[model samples]
Target: MRPQTTLRRLAEMKAARDPIVMVTAYDYPTARIAERAEVDMVLVGDSGAQVVLGHDSTVSVTVDEMLVLAAAVRRGVRSAFVVCDVPFGSTEVSDEQAVATAVRFVKGAGADAVKLEGGGAQRLSRIRAIVAAGIPVVGHVGLTPQTAVALGGMRAQGRTTESADRFVREALAVQEAGASAIVIEAVPAEVVDVVLPQLHVPVIGIGAGPADGQVLVLHDLLGITEGKTAVFVKRFAAVGDAMLAGVTAYAAEVRSGAFPAAEHGYPASADAIAAAAAAAAAAAALEPGQIAD
Candidate 1:
């Protein structure tokens, strides 16, 4: 109902009636489209590692690469709060190192905020430190791709009573650590159902539903892959299919010498064209001495 600050607006939307609609957009064009469509948040997610770089998981992306995409997304997005992910291995060192990496999103890539995995684990101190350094933090809880190796492969989390309770506690810990929002991913629906009302900060869900907000990997939503779409994702348009069809048609036309007809080329009055060409040649041949000084 009121004018919203970038990430703070997530808090407002959570407070108000409408649930925030967020999405992951790794590049400039996708960011521009999402911003124009009035998405509340746009994340330059390292899921680009999977979709763009052809990595099997998000593990291969680096902070520097994410920063590059984040800066480009920042330049493209005008309205939505743009959040960038801190990639795998970027924060393994220390708090100061985390703050330094976070600074690249601000000073280098121009992101409004940064998202990182873990809440009370190795990431808690770093989350606080980054916030203390005046950087907004988005805490990622429940399931983190950066820990794919440790997680023993991709699987849904919080099936057990203890794991569910731990997930809720970690969500609170992240909120306590000064995260403006928490990205709730790959957790049980019931767990999210309970935590959503309890969290003071906004919750952006991936697999979890009807949270304070929701986020989907853009590639999944765009139908960019013929392989598989995540269960939680919905395809809003068939952009990938249409683009491939269009490209294939163009290639066929080029191969068959059916494109570029005369009508598609230079169409001008012969006398005017001759005059223009002559004038262009005369201008090119002229020297300082031949000019009217």
Candidate 2:
């Protein structure tokens, strides 16, 4: 087996200019795929609210829901560093609440680190609290889905001058608060480039362009999600089409009675067949009102 990826290894990769690969995985199968693909990080992202659980937004996902997903991903991963998203409301109330939430992910889900969205003052305090509690943290800045409504919807951040300045400040604050790594999403590449020189930790870009690493939702990359996706998402495989085709073929076969053909079944011994025949005969001989022995 390959050696498990560690924070030290990730740091080395950043120093060596090796792009860290991360993917969000919600369950065992997806996590197993990520492990087999040799990804550097596996995120049990709150995006599971929309991707897996059919919720409309990330905020709807609770800490308990995230924990279940994180634990499942943990069971399927052995090599990649696993980070669980501390869902909205879990950490927003108070620093103590944030620490408790982080503890749950570490103790219950085996998360190597917990990721928190936003880099505002409260968020920085929460990051500090979680880190002080002995849990590593990955900070998220730019277009945080948890508070998209407040940011004027899920759109690209750092596009305006003021927005760009805020983005830079937040990203730096998050790093200063002791985040082991950071994820920058939906920000202009130019903005990210300016901050790259300043951030010492690994910076994983989603829609923010190249940095120390990149991450994408597994479903998005695998073509499992329908309709339009974000501009940054690039589908690497048509797994959804393949799945549909397989299921369509099965349904057609089932409807036409083409499935469960003679060769599809197990063969019984001659003695077993004879015993079944005798049992049928005995049943047929039973009186209408009598029970068989």
Q: What is the C-alpha lDDT of each candidate?
A: 0.83, 0.95
Give lDDT: candidate 1, residue 115.
92
lDDT of 1 by residue, 114-157 (tens): 89898666788989999999999999988888885665556677
Task: Tell me the spans in candidate 1 whose CA falls farther than 4 Å from its real position.
Answer: 1-4, 268-293
Q: Cα-based RMSD of the predictions, in order?
A: 4.6, 1.5
Predict model 1's lDDT versus the native: 0.83
Task: Report how far off residue 287 is in candidate 1 (Å).
Answer: 28
lDDT, candidate 2, 195-282, per-residue tens: 8999999999999999999999999999999899999999999999999999999999999999979999998999999999999999
* Candidate 2 lDDT score relative to the true structure: 0.95
Error of 2 at 240 (Å): 0.2
